[model samples]
Target: MKIVSSEGQFQGINHNRAMEPAHQPVYEMVTRTRTRTRTIAAGLVVANLALSGLLSKADNYNGNNTPPADGGYRAEACESAKQYHYEHAGFNAPGNTGGGNSRADVNTDTNWFRFPVNFQVHMLSTNKIGATTLYKAQMDQLDVTNSNNGAIMGLDPSTNSTGATAVQTNPAGWFIESFFNLNLRQSLDGGHTYTPQPTHVVLTNHNPPVFAMAPLLPPLGGRYGGETNSKIFFCTNFSSPCCTNGIIITNVIHTGFSTNFPPPPRGSNAVHTFSSTVSFNISMDNGLSFSAASAPAVVTVSVAHRTNDLFDPDTGRTTMVLDTEMTQLDISGGTLPAGVKLRQSPAMPSDGITTILSNGPSSYMISSSFNIMPELSLDNGSTWIPTCICKRMKHIPPPDYPSTCLSNAPLGFWRLNELSGTTAFNSGSLGPTANGTDTSIVQGDPGANLTGMGANNFAYSFNTTAFVDINSSSLNLNTVTVAAWVRIPTGFLSAIVSRGTNSWRLYIDNGGHAVFQTGQGGAAASTAPVDDAQWHMLAGVYTSSTFIEQIFVDGVLAGPISSATVPGNPTIHTQIGAAPDGSQARFFGDIAQVAVFNQALTAAQIQTLRTAAGGPPSSPTPVLTISPGLGTSFDITCFFGTTVQRTYSLSSSPNWTTIGSNASPYILTVTPTTNAAFFRLVR
Candidate 1:
C-alpha cells in the first residue's frame, strides 16, 4: 500500500516510419535432422546413449564447471552462475556479436550455465502470426543437460560469441530466446527430468543477493495475484562472473504487440497496426532478485492489435501506438528493507490483438474512433465509464454487502482497480504533452507515460464480480431509470455511488452537480446537480405510482429527489466507485450510456432518454436498414424522426388497422390477407 511513486515518464511519438510489417519469409533458414553427440568417461560416469528414438540429455550443473554435489547445485552456488552471465548479457562466447547488450564487457565464452531439464516458453499467437511480430521473451539457452547438451543460439546481427550464455540468467542471449517457443515440443527421455523455458526454477544473481522462497498461492502461483510485494532489476556488466546479482521472480511473462502486419495476399487485405505499452516490473527475493532497483510493478501493460482486411486490392488501415515500460534504478539514496513492503495491483491480466477484421468487405473497425476508452474516475474527476466499458469488467467483486474486502481484488473477490486518471482509459492524451504535463514520461514511451507513475493514476479498482449474477438473479430494480455520461475534473469530489447503504448511485457533487443516491441505512438520498462541464445525461426515476424520486439533468425536469421511501431492494448488490461509507469514493470523470430500468420513466420518458444520449432513440443508433418486406411487409409502419414515439421501421404494411382513438396521421393503408401482413405501433 505504499504506492504513489511517480518519476518515470518518457513520451516520444513519431511513429510514422511505417513500412516493415511484412514478415512471412523464412523460406528455409535451416531444417536438418539426425543429430547426436556423446563422449564421456570417468568419475561417477553415467553414459548409455541409445539411438532408437533419440532426444535425451540430463546432467545439468555447470555453474563454472560443476563442483557442488551432496545433493547437487551449490558448487559455490554454481560459481554465481558465471556471475549471472557477465552481469547480464553482453556476450563473450559461441559467436559474440555485441552491440547494445553491454553489461560489463567480458568475452571468455560467455560462461555460467545450467539446464538439466525444464524449458517451455511458448508465446506465439499474434492471433496465429498471420503477420505482426515484436516478441520479447528476452533470453534463453536451454541445454537441460545431456542430449549432447546442445546449443541453439540465434539473435546474430553479425556474430561474435553467439555461444548464447551471458547469463544475466541467460540475458537476452539466444536473441530473445529464438523468438519464443520452447514448451517441451515433444522430445525428452534422458534424465534430469526436463522442464526449462521458464519451467519454474530460478536463482540468477551477481552480488548483494538475497533469495528466499515460500509464497505460492495461486493457480500455481504463476504470480500476478494480489502480488504481495516485489522489486528486482539488475544488469551491470559481465563477461564471466563480474558479480552483482538480482533475481526473485514470483512470475513474469508479458506479450502485447499492437501491430506488425504482413500476411494477406491470397485474396488481398493484410492490415496490421500495433500499439501496446502498459509496463510494470518487479522481482524482489523470490526469483533471486531483479533490477530497476526493485519496487515498481504496480501492474501495467495494456495492449491491442489486430489485422485481416482485403477485398479486391484494398488493405489500408494500419496505425499502431501501444506502450508500456519499466526498468528503474537511476537511484541516488538508499533505504529499502526491514520487513519489506511494496505492492501493486490496478489492472493486469494481459490481453491484446483485438479484431483483425476482414471476414467481410474490407471492414475492421474497433478504434472507438481514437478515444481508446478513457473516461475513468477513481473518485477524482467525478464520473464516467467507457474505457472499453470500464475495462470490460476488471475482475468483478465489489458490492460485498457492506464492503471491507479488497485485499488484492481480482477474481477471488473482484475490484479491478475501479477507476483512476492520468487520462487514457480513453480520455485522449496518449502521453507526451497532450496534458500528461511531461512528468518524465517513460512508462513505455509511446505518447509518454500513458498512465504510469505514482500509484499509477490514483483510484479505480472494482470487480463487483463484473455485474451479472448478483447472487443468482433478482434484479427487479423497483421502478427504475438511471442514466450516465459525466465528466467532473476539478478536485473531483466523490459519489458515483457514495454508498448510502444497500447502494445504487450516480454521482458528482463538489458543486459540479449531477447526483443520484438511492437508499438503505442512509435514508434513501438523491441528488441531481448537472454541473455543466459538457457531457451530461444524469437521471433518476422511481415513481412506484408517484412514490416520488425523479431528477433528470440533461433531459431537463431538473427536479424531484425528495425521496421519502424508494431506497431499493431487488436484492441489493450494486456498486460503482462505492460510497455509503465503505471508503473508496471511486468514479472520477467520464462515463457513457449507463442504464438500468425496470419501468418508471416519465418526465417525458426522462427527456426521451436524455435526447438519446450518444444516439439510439431513433436514427443513427438503430440499424436494420432493410429486412421485412414480404408482401409489402404488413401495412408497413415506421416511426422515429426524433422519437416520433421511437420505433424505427415496423413491417406489416399488409393489414391490422384498429384505427384507435390515439392516432398519429392514421392514413390506414391495408391490402392482402395472407401474403404476409401485420403492423402495430404503440409507445
Candidate 2:
C-alpha cells in the first residue's frame, strides 16, 4: 500500500509516547580519536647561509625597502593583491586548479592552497552537525623576511583581498602554532573520502580503504561488535621564535545519510532522525564569549527511513517513506548575550530545493538547508554585520591572521572597525583621510599597521582619536567589570583602557593577565597575569570604595589584588588596543566583544553572560568545559583556568574507565577505551 503528505514543526525532539513514561535512549558507548602534533625543537643546522643583514654581526633584513614607490599597488582588486603577494609571501597564485569538491577555487584565489602544507579534512554526517571533532596541524614556526632578515615586515594586504600574503616574523624566543577546529562534520579523512555507518553516524577522518572504522562514534560494548576508530597527527620544531609561526586549522565539513533510532522504552514517541548541519560559535574571554554561528552552505538531505509492516511484513515494499519533515531553523538571534550576535548566510551557488514528504507510502525525500557564512559584528552586541562589512585594515593584509580570500577576516574574539570614512580624532583641519600617504596610512605597508590573529589588527593615525575613549564617565564603575577578547600577534605588549594622570584604566600585560594601574606614576596597583594568545575574557571588579579588585578568567576568579584602586576622580584618555602611556605596548592582535559595566557582576552573572554567549562554565573550580557532547564519553578543548594543569578527561558512564590524564589537552583517547560518557563543566 502506498500513500501521501507529511509535515510537522519541532522546537527540539523528545523520545516518548503512550501510557508508560518514555525512557531516554541510553547511549550504548562513546569513543574519540584525537590527533595532536606538539611543537618540536628545530635541530640547529650550521649552514652558514648567505647573509642579507646590513649589520655584519646582527642578522636582520634591511629596514628600508621602498614600499611600491607611490603605493601603486592600490590598483584593481587583483593587481593590488598581486603586489601585496610579491611584498609578502613572495609567490604568485597558480593559474588553473582542477575544479571539484576538493580542488581550490582558482578564480577566487580566496584561501591559501599549498601542496602538502595544509591539513585538509572533509566530513560526511548523518545527524545534524554539532560540535564534532577538532582538526589540527603543527609545524616548526618559520620566520619570513627579506634576504637581510633585518626588518620585521608583513605582507601589505588590500582591503578584503584574501590573496595578499601578509607574513609576520614571530618574537625572539616565542614560536607560533596556528590552530582552528573542525566544527562541521561532513568528511574527516580529507574531502576525497567519506564513510557512513549503519548507526547513521560520521567518523572524524574520510581516508578511503580502512572504511571499516568510525573515528568519532559512541563505543559499542555489551551490544554487538565493539566499535573501531583511528586518528593521525604530526609535529614540527623551530630553532628561534622569529620564524616559529605555523598553520593549524579545524575543518568543519559534513556529508552523510540519515538514520533514526527506535523511541526509548517509556519516553516520548518522537523518533529523532539525524542530518548534518554546520555552525560557528565565537568567544571573547577564551570560551567566555561562546556565541553559536552557522556556516554558508545550503546542504539539503532528503531522508527516507526503511521500515516493514507487521501483518503484511513479507509483502512490504523495500523503501518506506517514514513520516518526516526537514526544515531550516534560523537560530542566529535566538538566545545570546546583549553584546553577542550571530549569522548564517547562503554560500556561492545561490538557491536550492524544498522537498515534499509523505508519512508512509511511496519513498520520498526530506530536504534541508545549511546556510552559514564568515560571521562578523561591529559593536559588541548592538548590531550584527557581514564578515565583509569589517574591511581589512588599510595596512594589514591576507593569509596573515584569521581569514581567507573569499571570506571576511575572522575577529576570532577580537573586534575590528570598517574604515570607509575617516578617523574620529583628527589632528589637522583636513582630518583623517585615506589618500595613500603617511598622513592616512590607507591599506598598504604591513610595517605601518598592527595585525592580529583573525580580526584584531588596527590602522593608526598618530592621531590619538584612533584610540576609542573609555573613561569613568563614558564607562563609569565604582564597582566595575571590564571584559575584552584579545590576541597579541607579537610584541612586548600592553593594551590600555585609559591613560590618566592620577587615577587610571586597565589593560593586558605581556604575560597575559589583567592589569589595572592607578594612583599616578603608571604603577599597576592591581594586576593579574593572563598571557595565552587564545582569546581570554578578563574581568576586573573594583568592588565598593576600598582598593579591592577581583580578577576572573573564563568563569573562575583568578588571583585578586586587595589593594587595587583608581586613585579617585582623575582624568584619563582611553586606549582600546595599545597603552597610551609612552611605553608603546601596542596590541598586535584583534580585540572584540568589549564591555564595561557600571556595577560589578557576581560570579553567577558572569556565568550567565558566558552561557548567553554559548560558553557554559565547566564543573569544579578551574577545569572549564573542555569538550561536551550530550551522552558521549570523550572530551575535547584546552583548559586554561589552571596555570598548573596540563590535560583533562571526563566520563559519564560508571563502567567506562579513565585512560590517562596529562597536562596537555590531548590526553583523552577517542577510541572505544571508554563507554558512553557525558562531560560538562563541574564547578
Q: Kindly list the per-residue Cα lDDT of model 1 for residues 1-683, writing each as its tens digit.
A: 00000110011111121111121101100000101111111100111111112111111112122222221221111111111111112222222221111111211122222223221111221211112122222223322232343332122122111111111111100101111111221134544233222111111111110100111111011111111132122223322232323323222222122333332332222223333322233344434444432232222223322122211111233222111111111111123232333222123212211112222221121111000112222233243222111011011111211021111111112112223323212121111121211111122211111111112222232222111112212233545556544444542445553224444455655565565545532222224444444445566666556556666765565654555355564544444444434433555443332345556566654543332221111111110011123464323222221111222233453324444333322223344454433233433
Give the lDDT of residue 310 in candidate 1: 18
How much lDDT does candidate 1 score? 0.26
By TM-score, how accurate is candidate 1? 0.22
State each model's CA lDDT, in order: 0.26, 0.27
Error in Å for residue 535 of model 2: 1.8
Per-residue C-alpha lDDT of model 2 across residues 37-102, encoded as one tens digit per residue? 111111100000111111000001111122222111110011111101111111111121111111
Which candidate leads the pack in TM-score?
A: 2
After superposition on all CA atoms, what RMSD does each candidate show versus the true structure?
26.0, 27.1
